[model samples]
Target: MNTASWGSAGRFGLARYVMAAALARTADGGAVVAIVLLVTTQGGSGSLAGFLAACITAPHLLGPFVARRIDLADDGRKVIAFACVLYSFALAAAVLSYGHTPAILTGLLLSISGCCGPLLTGGISSRLPTIVGSDQHSQRRAQGWDVATYGIGGTIGPSVVAAVSSWASPGLAAFCLAVAAFCAAWLVMRLPYSAPEHGGDVQNVPSAWSTIALMVKDGPLRRTLYMTMLVAFSMAALPITAVHMTTLIGSPAASAAAMTAAYGIGNLTGSIGVMLRPLRGSPDHLMSVLALCVIAGLFAVMVSPTLLIAIATFWLAGIVNAFFFAATLAARTEYAPAKGRGQVFLWVAAMKITAGSAGTAAAGAMTGWDVRIPLIVGIGLIGCAVALSFVERSMERF
Candidate 1:
């Protein structure tokens, strides 16, 4: 039952899980771009497109509940696959309903898809401990690959939509996302069954609220989640700041796009680096080191005189950030109680989403005043996270 071995079958199972996760995340990532493009091209107003995007994104806050359901399900795999199927169907429905049916109807369908979004992200991550068993080395390696999937999806998702929408039609492009989700659903089913639950009786698993309390009580886990949210706040502000940088430096709008792509490439590079040379010693220690690196990178970005320089700094920041992410994942696996692992992962992810949204809004408001303002704020957030990491280390002394 321990699928942790690096044998052929184990490798294949891991590959399937990675590929499926990539596809599911790609669909989730591209849905917003596809929706915006489709609506705009079809004469729908930008506000309407924004409304639809909001509908799809706002419900992502419901991810912890979805994770709870999966944790409690008789067959977790089936529940995950079901969520993917619903995500696929809802995407297709939204695509078809746009302009043909009422806008509200389309929004409703997208909202349904959004509600299922967590399974594609944190939900999948929550399964990693079980997939690789309790070996810290195996979990670390698997997490490297897992982190790469996010980079793959984040980079390719919008590119796929842009290329397809340009060549064929937005409708086709949007439908393609739905198809990707469906394929992911099939792949989810192909994953190996759970390797016999080990923590306790599934029937006696604590309720979501109780699980949440457990997560909060674990100091390491709590610190990990808090630091992650702080880092996310900084990340969410970058795009808007990048765009504003373009304006100040007289760089083309595409430069901002390039900066985004660079970040994705950096993320991929970092993930691969970790896979080749998995972190040793404590993940918490590495987190502190990586957090310092990110802070340095952000400082370079803040001081960049040229748009190109800014893009390069962002890429470097992304690489360190990915390593930081792996450390957090390792922390989560090591510290979270097995019975509540799913809730811990999903809820932490949800908190990141909430924090990122707030960061984005704050950045959007501040850009009119000055672009440096947001970067300064991001730097401050990282500083705060690093400070918290020190506090945690101090707590361990006692």
Candidate 2:
């Protein structure tokens, strides 16, 4: 048997995908921070802030429907590029509320723009195999690379939003981040766009319900989704808790910046780790480790009495978060059937979006509650997910 080299898999497509994914993720991370701060800081009601967050996040529930276009398109790149352009404009429009625009109007604009998120995220994720190569090793590496870009974006977006909004204003910060969508569109346009693979029968395609039903009925797919679902719940609460972290350390002007930066720096470290040594184990083992990372980080955060200790805990969490994404991608590579794989990717990404929104909403509803509540909840949920873990080798396999 012959082994394939990473050099042989082609770098141009991978580079393009990474660029596009990073910009999209950065825009997303910045937008989340911008909207929350833009609202709450400006004396807007907590309800309104949560509403805006939901406006941006809820549309992703339409992912399966919206992403079908990508799954069926002749060229997913064109579809993605076109979507990115629209998303950019819509997000820019939403930033208008920072100028004292009406919340209703801003929410409407945000909802309109956010519908494109799944395309940028899941739609792009589904394109990985085509962009990099169809081989398992290539696809797995592609997934790790994708996670790396997302981690970078997630790391940088918040600090940029925090610093810019604090120094300048939320409107400027949001508008600036909106530029990422334009960048993503251009990079996507330059992708080594490949047609759908040869020899698959389009007519034999599974009905959306049937495909979803199959995924629902399948153990590994079901479990994978469950794990991400739990993770998302915890992740959603971070923005609010981040604000609290800032308040705790007596730096209202730099609220959450330290913790968010710690997470971002840690995420970058994890991405580099993936580049150097991509996960070399089965999906379950990776998931277990990822769970442990989250659990440990949250535990450390829970016990920390000072800002410095909290930063280190947040950093640990960020590192594991990167590995969690890589591990999830590995799970998809291992379990998702070629048939309806696009749907699976979109579904996975969409779940994260939706779950995060729900968690944020939950945190928002507890406005007067202790800051530690959400973090504790996140830890417990992840702990439960770990308990559900299943391994491989027929000993842990199908």
Candidate 3:
């Protein structure tokens, strides 16, 4: 009711949710970096590094199950709060496993922690409406704030990992990530808690599988999901390309930091642009912009002769990435049915996160071929996605 409440959090936000989400996203951003560092520190090979990363992300595939439960339950916050605690403990175990345990055991602990990713990202996302109410304008602003905070977290997370790992150790970075999750848990506890049956009538609640089926049956939502998956796939090239380019340029690894900074700055800038002037158009229009950004960004990386050019291009791509996601979140908020919103939110999160992970891993394999080859493939996929969006428009006219 009062704009002041949201205003205090900065940019029309819920302070508590924004704080918790920022912490969660930071952990999400850092955990992979920490995992790689830990594996390498432990004298493990690249395969093990990839495997541990998978352990952390693979659980996203099952995120929908918890999201479904959250939707059907009275209060989703309880599920999220519990997940927060679980991640803290599980990640701690992962930290312990780094020395005494084998990679498999460490990975097992990471997998346990990974289950919390979806709940933290998508599950918490579903709570936005509860905090901000359903008014379109207010909700979009809140979502934009969310996007900005998420970018801020992404920017901070890796920096934290790199700094901590360099000065102290990779193990310490993992511990810091756990502390972030613990802090997130504490923050969630401060939020208004509700019982599990907020919606009432268990019999009326549909299963997650059925909801997913219904969602896919919709033409626009399905198309949007498919299109975004392509963007996610392309976006993977950013990290892989950054790592490779650093090696190629023989520049200090810190050069990669500049690239990341550019991306983060771009994301914050783009999110504000969306919040300032919300676009009005079909989802196809939004997806087209997203795809174009991916195409241009990747192409820039492929052709960049110097590290400076790559940084500039990455900055532009980051702007497009942030804009694409902010606009898409608002669109998803608008399209999702009231009853099934939680499931849909998590489903989208799961799909995009998984696709991004797969893209990164796949890209890693191709670095041996040529640094630019993976990004080239990423650009082509994004272009195809853009083409598909136009096809949908043409079909609608027919």
Candidate 4:
């Protein structure tokens, strides 16, 4: 494609994809928050809330295999479109089925929505390089846009749910989420059919599990995967911080929402950084710095128990996290074999899922031992990640 053609495709594709991503994120965040709140209101314990949280991360464990399958397909465009539609319908069904009597069915529907989550995210990651432009700079910029969209959507979605839940009802919040999902599906439907350039027949395609095994055997890919998992585990501190601030410090829901908003702002800012200047140093070096910054931010959280201070610290942590995550993703994408891009991204998603599930479960279990226990553990893990970065640097040089 010519420069003009590439630019036009990127503009059009980004516009539509961002809409879809934002809606998808809004649905995902709003549904999780709303479900937890509803369950609690219905006299359920924190265990139920934790289970719902786990539901959100559980599908990630399967994302790698899913990505492999999607990647092997000749028609990724169709797969993405179908997934979007199915996801939308599922969210809508969950919204419509909300009530006290059919609680079990409602939970099942919510879990189903979670299962569709990775398919959309992974599909987009794989599709963007094809549709936007193949150049590394252009591809990075496109991913930056994606990151910003998630931040904006994530920041807004939870606040919307919180507002609706407090003023109206959880059902209303869920309904809004359903509408967002439908909008995402509509936006996705407009894109041109773009698939991986490495065309091959289905009969020759490798199994998803085999692809994952091959990726794992690659040293840089494995290191990157570990880094992603650590970063994700560290982020578990975010929700835990919110819960702590509300339960222990007597902070209002607005405070939690503001903290989240600040975190989103940090992510947006980091995306801008990625667009403006390339991290000229090695990925390991940059990631090491980011890891230390993350630890510093977590420590800040530990010391500052008040609402405003906590919010500021969380926002700073978010900025650091944005840099860390964006850099890691860019590196992973750069290192991935062209044919294995989808599987690589899928592995990243799976790591995130595994880390998030572990972190949340641990956090929920240790909620009694000081609400900030998870944050401490997060800080320690980032420390380990920092150490691992040095090892990665040496490996790279060799």
Question: Could you give candidate 4's per-residue lDDT for residues 253-349 as a string of tens digits?
Answer: 6677777667778778887777676455556466677778888877886787678887887778787877777667676667877666777776777
lDDT of each: 0.82, 0.76, 0.79, 0.71
Lowest lDDT 10-mer window, candidate 1? 195-204
Candidate 2 residue 104 Cα shift, in angstroms, is: 4.8
Q: So what's the TM-score on candidate 1?
A: 0.94
Error of 1 at 251 (Å): 3.1
Evaluated at residue 361, the lDDT of candidate 1 is 91
Indicate the residue-level lDDT of 131 in model 2: 64
lDDT of 2 by residue, 45-124 (tens): 88888889888878887776666566566667888888888888988888775457767888888887678888778777
Ordered from best to worst TM-score, the candidate numbers read: 1, 3, 4, 2
lDDT accuracy of residue 144 in candidate 2:
70
Give each prediction's root-mean-square deviation over alpha carbons: 1.9, 3.8, 3.1, 3.2
* Prediction 3 TM-score vs. true: 0.88
Q: Residue pairs in steric clash, candidate 3? A: 74-196, 74-197, 74-198
Which lDDT value does model 4 have at 237? 62
Give the clashing pairs for model 2.
Answer: 391-396, 392-396
